[model samples]
Target: MARKVIESVTCDACSKKGLEVPGTVNLTVMGDRYDLCDEHGARFRDQLAAALAPAVDAALSA
Candidate 1:
């Protein structure tokens, strides 16, 4: 088993301060973890939704 390092300080995506601090969440994707602020986290969520929206629409239409 590989060791999991818990370095929850800065946002891995944007290097924003106060990552994984109080009242924050830790995001993990494809075995990679990320610590993002509220701003970046909302952006990520919107992006993911947008990415899936087209596919979902297509599937529904078909």
Candidate 2:
């Protein structure tokens, strides 16, 4: 078996970065494969959610 590599991406929220621990997700979000570290993931998710809400709402409305 091949060893799995955990890819890390810079946090989208604070931009205060950390090493990305490995995990699984249904789809990659905001160009990152997994959530950011505790310092920024929450803020990143919130910002992403807010930024995407209008688009999502429009899609849903349509």
Candidate 3:
């Protein structure tokens, strides 16, 4: 049995296209989950970190 994906979003970091397919990072918010590719997932995480707080920007180099 396989779990169905809820939604698919493009990688905000890389322009690569992705689908709501399996084998990807999943994040559930408000009873909904978004599927992101590996590269984009990292980017999404970074964006989320930055959005959550300001410390993320200070941790960046240059």
Per-prediction tally of clashes = 0, 0, 0
Winner by TM-score: 1
TM-score of each: 0.58, 0.45, 0.47
Per-residue CA lDDT of model 2 for 1-62, tens digit only, reads 89999865543433434444432222365785644455455556688899999999999999
| Top candidate by lDDT | 1
Ranked by lDDT, the better of candidates 1 and 3 is 1
All candidates in order of lDDT, best leading: 1, 3, 2
Regions more than 4 Å wrong, model 3: 1-23, 55-62
Which residue pairs collide in model 2, if any?
none
Tell me model 1's lDDT, rounded to 2 decimals: 0.70
In the order shown, the candidates' Cα RMSDs to the true structure are 6.6, 6.3, 8.2
The candidate 2 region of ten consecutive residues with least summed lDDT is 18-27
When 2 and 3 are scored with lDDT, the better candidate is 3
lDDT of 2: 0.57
For residues 1-62, what per-residue lDDT tens digits would candidate 3 score against the true structure?
Answer: 99998764553323334333343666667997766668667777887877966665566743
What does candidate 1's lDDT look like per residue over 1-62, in tens digits?
Answer: 89988754655556544234332547888998877667678888899999999999999999
Alpha-carbon shift of residue 52 in model 1 (angstroms): 1.2
lDDT of 2 at 25: 25
- In terms of lDDT, the poorest run of 10 residues in model 1 is 16-25
